[model samples]
Target chain A: MSDKPIALDAMGGDHAPHEVVAGAVHAVRERGLSVVLVGPPRVLYEALEDHRATKEVPIVRADEALAMDEGALASLRRPRSSIAIACHLVRQGNASAAVSAGSTAGIVATGRLRLKGLPGVLRPAIAVALPTLPKPTLLLDAGANADAKPEMLVQFAHLGAAYAETAFSIGKPRVGLLTIGGEAEKGNKLTRRAHELLTASPALHFVGNVEGHDLLTGLADVIVTDGFTGNVALKTMEGAVQYAFTELRNTVNAHRAARLGALMQRGALRDLQRRLDSEAHGGAVLLGLTGTVVIAHGSSRAAGISAACQLAADLEKGGVVTRIGERVASTHRTHRLW
Target chain B: MSDKPIALDAMGGDHAPHEVVAGAVHAVRERGLSVVLVGPPRVLYEALEDHRATKEVPIVRADEALAMDEGALASLRRPRSSIAIACHLVRQGNASAAVSAGSTAGIVATGRLRLKGLPGVLRPAIAVALPTLPKPTLLLDAGANADAKPEMLVQFAHLGAAYAETAFSIGKPRVGLLTIGGEAEKGNKLTRRAHELLTASPALHFVGNVEGHDLLTGLADVIVTDGFTGNVALKTMEGAVQYAFTELRNTVNAHRAARLGALMQRGALRDLQRRLDSEAHGGAVLLGLTGTVVIAHGSSRAAGISAACQLAADLEKGGVVTRIGERVASTHRTHRLW
Candidate 1:
């Protein structure tokens, strides 16, 4: 891979400009990776001063930025938005990849517009790697398309299969369709049709239908579903994890000995927390794009932003796009669904 | 109500007959409840011998029973099934309520066939009380109908609202439509349409829309969605809780101090576990039926079976069916939806 740096959206996320710049500097210094910050020159330059990285990390000026509260339309409204500029950098080969912690809708919309989709790719999917036993499970369409056709789901399976092979090195990745029941006949109209298509497809190692409970059990390498259900399932799992920890903390605090014990084993507990943390994986990747586009968590700080940069660089090196494109093209040719 | 007993499916669940008979005896002596065990007379009588409950708990013969793996079709195939007989007891006024731990689909199909729906009810929904802070949040359509129309969701909200009010004593219970986003227009076609209808309905205290993460936050008294999404969400939450506990256990056992601390705080931890246990809520209630019907977990033992019976008896006393009927009647009359 060329020494093309990852373009970081500086004016994005909750602690943007500063945290993002700090993360870029951390990547360059700690991880030995090149990064280019994208945002207004004055704002980014001032933020980079804290890390003494003004000269080390290059800055690409983006005049306007989409508000955090804005939707997909903001990508069109602010053509020079930090996320847009980051995508442009990837498109122009100035950067190997784009990483942004901006509004999910805005980033997805702009990435689609700037990088476009792989040939025969009906729609791009936001693939999130879930923390499960054995290995991370790849769940796709995590919010890219709220509504999806059966054909799109079949395509998603192939996209996820390729991603698993490239990112996680899972050969012949088993794919499961997310639905209410394990039976193939079960689920809503869309799922039933998709189940049939997936079962018939030769490219995907279809494992039939899996319920939401199978998500954390590592039943399949990739779980494919419409973006709405996928997004809800993802968030619901996150909330449950937090709720459990809060309950655990309260239990430990209820007794003195328990609190002392928790203190004693705080190291192991921290390790568990880190392993389960959503930000540890460096955010969701927008797959089926022409380039590697990583969407960092919105509330990410320095560590999360830096992790995302590292992930973008890794995905670029692993050739995720080319793998997905080839897989999609082969599936599209064989199935002729998309 | 009258001295009408709860008709229990002695042929249902993992430890059926024995556990069912034991639970009946427990419910009678501990809670002062009338109970009738429905199964093959010989099997129930032989099992009841262990508890010396043969004389204390009445037995009603139901020659046939549905299998654990059976679906909705089994309800018709085995008209004399224990679950069918239990529902028959409810319809015949011999039992005020029915409790079963058989296949959910079989119980639902039998209940719909025997008790039928309330006056204005279109489709029945399974309502489960989620273990959440403040109070258990009621989630409906846990898997009765895999597919639902937009208007069906409107009815589900009213069903859930009535259940929440009757079961939890929440007045003007706020109902939330489950969606991908908090915005009214953020979900797919069904959810988006349901959101609009819910927002317009004067019969409900609709609280816009809630994401999957809101399931355990007690954000709304009742969360309503299509059966498929609701089932997936409910199972996902359960899976997440189990995963967290497993992880916590591993962390606690990682060191001697942590294990000792866990032992010292076992009381508080047990209380938390009980509070979060789905079984503690006495399983799920099938709503919109003419009579109250509670479906215990299929793997439920004696204590869980007793809890389900208690829940059925409580719902009968709470007038859940009557309340739902009146609410649906007025709403249907007001909107002419039916």
Candidate 2:
């Protein structure tokens, strides 16, 4: 529908070019989205041929690929890495957005090194959509920067707010600082200082401190935390969900009545499964970058990759990068941190 | 059938005398556990009279009550407080254990001040039973000490291991240090150092660092962390469970087929609910105490309180206090931290 094409890091993720190329084909065929697959040309063409989609999905030659085991420094050195080349496409106006399912550190590092950070932005933050009640809650700094200053947390809030508004169409999203308790001074020194900083930020709809319990209750549209806590909470919730479903499956098979019940409830159960599936929400977005960059799960399949491409296209159409830049610029103009 | 009686802090929790007294009656009548209700006799008797259970439940006279608003100092000043009196009963060998659904801080303070910590124990840590698969996982230092040293974390591992062995009947429980990641060097400085200390400890089954995702997977029988992270993780998991159920309810009610499906899956749903219910496992136990003290939810109802009383009695029968003392005494003989 739109002329803007997405740069797909075909060499990234668990399935590499095979699933990535299939996902690109699906996006173009089913979702009517333009995508330029970036990876080793021969490998990507073969993968596309396997899907009988080589003619449909175009491939951009990228000689190098950043392995999943590599660290952030690898992204800096390997400028020709698949994710880096994808970002370069976005920066060079050949593509509107870049999507990768490689190592998070690599994506964040390459996004910053290649596309560069937005004007006035202190640091880039990773925002993941949590499937919370009423809607998906946006949690920022999921695991980008572990040791962030209080000022950096404030910027994360602004960045999360912009993403929530643009991606979810949530207007003036209520932001809450993640802490141990709901009280103003309950958490460690970092949270205490962040609470004050967030409350003072006029750009954010600061709702005060929210405990871990508030993350999924729709207590706030945007939940901001230092990467340390946010990463733990996010992973904990994901693990719990997995455990619950596993238990639910076991419970369903425990008795004949339960088995029958499961059969009848299959539709509802599938809907619930879809809602809880992390792949359905695409993946984490590296915010504050000059270009839109989405980092999918490393173990992501074709569905997840396609979802990530859709997410990247949506973010590009929504002008998330420009909005984040504007918000950072305004915040810095008022209260400069860097 | 147990001869040992538990002293219930009647003037505690959100519902106070009503729920506590009702729970006491239920424990005695249903579970056959002897209980001595500790509170202001006049008010407690009136509450009992209202339930027509005065003759069934015996009340122990305690003139003062600790307000939920009060902190640690309240335990020292109000020596005659209900929770303090409950702990005193255990100290005097009149009651085998003490159970309170009051302020955690108040209970911890009263237990430590009135009954004192186990010999050579640096601090008492709270251990909560996580309803994980196969077997329940034990998470220690749920909120007792916010900022724990590496030594304290090692101590918590021992305490949790002991509780898991005695209470859960698990032998040589696999102890995992709860950190941001499963890798040994993946967490904050404290975790990295604690990993070394825990692995070096001869008393525990140190299985290395376990991430938040491992909590519900039963990766380790005993999971140890500082109170701050443990409390947050526990609450976060609880919140996610609540949110998941709420969303499931909404999804079921959305259409006729889904509603019919819900009716069919009602049995399995009830089973899942019972398995996920934290109250069924009773309250969190404050480990490393000279006396067995259990802290129930502040808003616990009759069944929850009854479960706490049952848990306290079970721990007492299993010699939780003696075992904790033995662990602390042994740890001291080797490391000499105290």
In terms of docking quality, model 2 is medium
Worst 10 residues of 2 chain B by lDDT: B255-264
Best by TM-score: 1
> Model 1 interface RMSD, in angstroms?
1.6
Per-residue alpha-carbon lDDT of model 1 for A97-164, expressed as tens digits? Answer: 99998888889999998997888899999999987767788888898999899999988897888778
Q: Residue B99: error of model 2 in Å?
A: 0.6
**Proportion of native contacts in model 1?**
0.81
**What is the TM-score (0 to 1) of candidate 1?**
0.96
Q: Indicate which candidate wins on DockQ.
A: 1
Candidate 1 ranges beyond 4 A from true positions: A255-271, A279-281, A336-338, B255-271, B279-281
How well is each residue in A234-315 modelled by candidate 2, as lDDT tens digits?
8888877766666665666665555446553567656686657753235699888888889888877888888888888888
